[model samples]
Target: MKFKIPDRRRLLIAASLLLSSAAHADDAARAQAAVTDLGTQLRSALMARVKAEGPVAAINFCHDQAPTIAADVAQKHGLRIGRTGLRTRSPGNAPADWQRVVLADFETQAQAGSAPQTLRYSSSEGLPEGIALRYMQGIATEAPCLACHGQTLAEPVALAIKAHYPEDAATGFREGQLRGAFWVEVSSGN
Candidate 1:
């Protein structure tokens, strides 16, 4: 009877762990989806803003509205979402300590001819002694990004960017380069 009881308890524990793992995976997937949707929203908005207000205005839109949009999305999804870059146009775009490490790794991989669009990473990190899901997707520089971030910027656009971001370092990018990444972090309700 005693042996049977222990066996049953062990089975219950194993089942609980399996269920927990599944739930963690679901949460991670939700976080990734939220980040993708948020990135689309921000990119689309910036594109429209640039079309209506021009590349100059697009820079301003990024400086002014991008954070707000990210914050809103994060709040809605119950996750932390944002972008970070190797050479940040806005100092605000500077990656956190962990993100800096990832960005450098990404830069190295990209230099080795990895498809920037296909570059991504996800991991579960111990947080508060529990596990949390973290994800990052590379932002490849495309033709549309050149107006402000290209190898050569228009004189006026450069001036506007300088006026706005006195410490701007996010430029001199070529098409297909790694501009940065959109990241999402969500706590597993463990």
Candidate 2:
């Protein structure tokens, strides 16, 4: 005896699968957009701070100001934002996945001698297996970025860093080194 599946049942299964995938994709896109917008605002504020103050001051300002900026934006948008940095060596000498990604992108741009810029990424590995995760660009170096993140750290820069973060291990950066990256999280209400 042979058995056959009903055509209506097959169609229903196919439609459900398609709908699920489409929903997942939409959520991911929304998360990406939210993080991208946050990155834009953060960069703008950082640039303005740098222009007003020197590199060391800019770094300090960012350290002081970024949290508030992120919090305000996240609260308004109903999202979460986290920041991390790239350094010559990872904290506790452990490998940092986020740093690795930023470094790779920074190296590619450096090899081509282009100005460093923001990079973005998305993932859906965790969180209900369908929710999208997003991160925004965090370039390692720029012309002005050198004072705080350069081949050789300036005296003032070193002092400032020590003052702010005594246990900070973020140093020994080259012109195009990946010094840090930002991670922003968003929830797609889908």
Candidate 3:
């Protein structure tokens, strides 16, 4: 099929739109991979600590190494990635303004019968510096996560959490519920 453009400007615009769409799709794929890699590394490290030392040691590892792990993954993926929620264990993990909106929407979607793991959001934002591709994937509370984030935590776990995060509010979660989200932002020149 032959397609005709009325003007060069219109043809350029069409090409730009197609290229932008392709770039967004690529960004989404990379963002998802980064989230998956970060989650896998974190879970593996936490499990190893729990097996070798204990739950408390796992908590300590999260406090000490989670940020480092996230940083490494972000660097490897050429984007910024982290976990966030309304109720955060660490202050550093608190959702930013835009993320708060997305998290709230994810919660609403979950309440409306969407599975937690099926909730995701992505958008492109124009920033002063450049355009940013933002993405979020919901994290479900699993049975294994109950060791630290369940309604009733063991004394040791509670103590360890308090020692690490005095303002913790990331508990009281049930299995299959929305725990939080993994967020990724890819910007121009990143």
Give candidate 1's TM-score: 0.88
* CA lDDT of each prediction against the hidden true structure: 0.84, 0.62, 0.92
Tens digits of per-residue lDDT for model 3, 38-152 = 9899989988999899999899889999999999999999999999988999999999998999999999998898998889998875643664699999999999899999999
TM-score of 3: 0.93
Give one digit per residue, the lDDT tens place, for model 1 in 1-190. 4445587899999998998688767877877788788879987998999889898888777888988999999888988889889898778778988788888989999999997877887777464444477778888999999988888999999999999989989889999999998887876563
Residue 14, candidate 1: C-alpha displacement in angstroms: 3.3
Model 2 has an lDDT value of 0.62
lDDT by residue (33-132, candidate 2, tens digit) is 6566667787788788778877687767866776678787777666666556544322332334654665576556656765445445555445444335
Model 3 CA deviation exceeding 4 Å by range: 1-5
Colliding residue pairs in candidate 1:
none
Clashing pairs in 2: 85-180, 86-179, 86-180, 119-137
- TM-score winner between candidates 1 and 2: 1
Count of backbone clashes for each model?
A: 0, 4, 0
TM-score of each: 0.88, 0.68, 0.93
